[model samples]
Target: MIIGCKDDVLPKPASQLRLDYPVAKYASFSNHCPIEFEINEDAVIKEDKNCEFSIHYPKMKATIYLTYKTVNNDIDNLLRDAQNLTYKLHTLKADEIIELPFINKEKRVFGTFYDVTGNAATNSLFYATDSIKHFVTGSVYFYAKPNYDSILPAESYVKNDMQHLMETIKWK
Candidate 1:
C-alpha cells in the first residue's frame, strides 16, 4: 500500500518582517550617474551623497530603492533642477505612471513632483534618466516601494503607500 500527503508552505518569521534600518550618515560614491534628494522619515532624516536606500516589502517580495540628497541649504537650485528633471522624464515611454513635471533637454533629463503637505513645508520628488538606469531623487517620509519593472497590476495599497511616502517629505 502507498500513502500520499499534501505539501504546505511555511510563513516567514517575525524577525524577517522587520526591515533593516539603512546605514545613516554614510557617504559613499558611485560610478552610476547620481540623483539627489532629501529624506524625512518621521524624526529620522537621512541624506544620500551618492548612495541610495533600498527597501523590500517581503509580503509582496518587491524591492524599491529611494535615492535622495538633502538640499536644505539651496532650495531654489533644487527646485529648478527638480523642474528640469521632470521635463526630461516626460519624453520617455515608460509603462509605469509618474505624476510629476520635468523637461527633456540634450544630454540631461529632469522631473519633479510635490509631496503631501500640511501648513508649513512641502517636499519634492525628482528623477533624471540617461541611456542606463533611471536616477531617482526626492524626499520621502514613509517607507516606500521602489519603482522597478517587477511590480504589476498597480494595486491601491501600493499607490497609497507611495503617495504617503511622497507626502511626508519636508524641504528643510
Candidate 2:
C-alpha cells in the first residue's frame, strides 16, 4: 500500500437533531379570573395584575402570557388589537399566518387562533372571548432567539397547549 494514497474527501450529509418531549398531561387552572382553562402539568402558572397570567414552562424556557379585559363596549377594539398583533406585528417575519376560527357555543367561547410560521417573535397567538362580558388574549414566547428551525419541537408542543387552552376556556 502507498503511504501517500488516501480516499477522496467529501462533506457529510446534513442531518437534523431529534428531540422528544413527554406527552402533555393537563390540569384545570383558574382563580379569580373570569376565564378558566387547562394548563400543561409540566408548566407553572403565575398570576399577574388585572387577571393576567404568565404560564411558564421551565424545561422549554417558554412562557404563555394571558391578559384579560372586560368587553363592555370595546369588543371591536379588542378584536382589532388582537388581529393587529398577529398580523401587523408578526406578519413581517412570519412566512405565513394561518387563521383558525374557534367557536364553542356551549362554552360561549368565540375567538381566532393565529398560527404564525417562520422566525417570528412568537409561534402562536390567540384570543378568546364571550363577545359581551369577557375577553382574553394570549401568546407564547420562547426564551431563546427566534430561530424557528431550532425550536420547532418545543414550539409545536407549546402551540398545541395554547390551542387546547383556548378550546377549553370558559368565561366565569
Candidate 3:
C-alpha cells in the first residue's frame, strides 16, 4: 500500500445564482377598466372581462393578478374579503405579515399592503378602494415553488412594481 500526505479536507464554498432584474419604468395603463394605474414597462397586461387583469412578468415567471369591483353598497364585504386573502390564507406558512396602510384621499384610494415573509404562496398583496364606488385588489405569485430564499430577488423587484401600481391608481 502506498501512503501520501494530503492537505486538510475542507468543504467547497457554495455558489449561488446571482439573480437580478432591470430598473422599473412605468407608464399609465387603462383599457375600458373602471380604474387605471401606472404599470411597469416590462409587464405584459392581459385585460380580462369585468375590469380584471393579469399582469405577466415572463422573466420572473410571475404574475400580478388584479380584480376590480364596483362598490354596490357592500364596501364592508369587499374589505373583509381582501383582508382575509392576505391574513387568513397565508398564515399557515408565512413567518410574518407586515401591513402597510395606504391612503390617497385626493385619489380616493385607501387600502392595506401586505408583505409576507417565509415560504408563502404570495409575497405581496394589496387592496385599494374608494369605499363608495370602486375596489381593486392585487397579488403576486411566482410560477416556481414558494421557496422564499430562491425567489427573494425577483420578489423584491416585483414588489416594487406592485407598490408603484398601487400608488398610481385612479378611479375612472
Candidate 4:
C-alpha cells in the first residue's frame, strides 16, 4: 500500500443526515376555553391557565405555547405585544424572518404568521384574533439549545403542526 495515498486520504463528500418522523396524525382538541383547534396526535397537551395551553412534543423536545385573551378593546396592544415577541427573536439569532398574513373572512379570523430561520430560540410565532372578543398567540420553543441545522427536521415537523393548529382554530 502506498504511504499517505491521496486517494485514500481524500475527505469524504459531505452528506445530509436523515431524520424520519412518523407521518403526522391530527385530532381535534377542544375544551371549555374560548378557543378550539386541532393538534398533532403525538403531542402531550397541558392546560396552563384559563385558556392557555402548552402543546408538548416530547420526542422532538419542543413545545407549542398557546395563549388566549379577550379582545376587550385591547386589540392594538395585543398586536403590538405579539409583533414584539416575534421581533425579539429576530434581534437575537434569527437569520431571516418571513411574515405570512392569514385571513379567514368567513371565520372572521385574521393574523400574521412569523417563520424564523436560523439558530433562533423559537422556529415559529403567530397571533390570531377576531378583532372583537378573541385573541390568541402561539410560539414553539425547543427544549434543546438552538441549532438550526441539527434541528431542522424536527422544526419543520412541528412548524407544520403549528400551521395546522392556526388554520383550524375557531372561537368558541
* Best-fitting candidate, scored by TM-score: 3
Candidate 1 local lDDT, 46-105, one digit each (tens)? 333455665434444433346654434554565566655444443353333345554555
- Tens digit of per-residue lDDT, candidate 2, span 1-172: 6577689999999998888999999999879877889999999999979898999999999999999999989899999999988888887899999999999999899999999899999999999988899999999999999999999999999999999999989878
How many backbone overlaps does candidate 2 show?
A: 0
For candidate 3, write residues 1-172 as lDDT tens digits: 9989999999999999998677799999977878889999999999877788999999889999999999999999999999988888999999999999999989889999999999999999999998999999999999999999999999999999999999999998
What would you estimate as the lDDT of candidate 4? 0.92
Candidate 3 regions with alpha-carbon error over 4 angstroms: 1-6
- Compared with the true structure, all predictions reach lDDT values of 0.39, 0.93, 0.94, 0.92
Q: Select the stronger candidate by lDDT from 2 and 3.
A: 3
Q: Which stretches of model 4 miss by more than 4 angstroms?
A: 1-7, 10-15
How well does candidate 2 match the true structure in TM-score terms?
A: 0.94
Which model is ahead, 2 or 4, in terms of TM-score?
A: 2
* Cand. 4 TM to true fold: 0.92
Highest lDDT against the true fold, candidate? 3
Q: How much is the lDDT of residue 110 in candidate 3?
A: 95
lDDT of the structure predicted as candidate 3: 0.94
Give the worst 10-residue stretch by lDDT in candidate 4.
1-10
Report the C-alpha displacement of residue 52, candidate 3, in angstroms: 0.6
Q: How many residue pairs clash in each candidate?
A: 17, 0, 0, 0
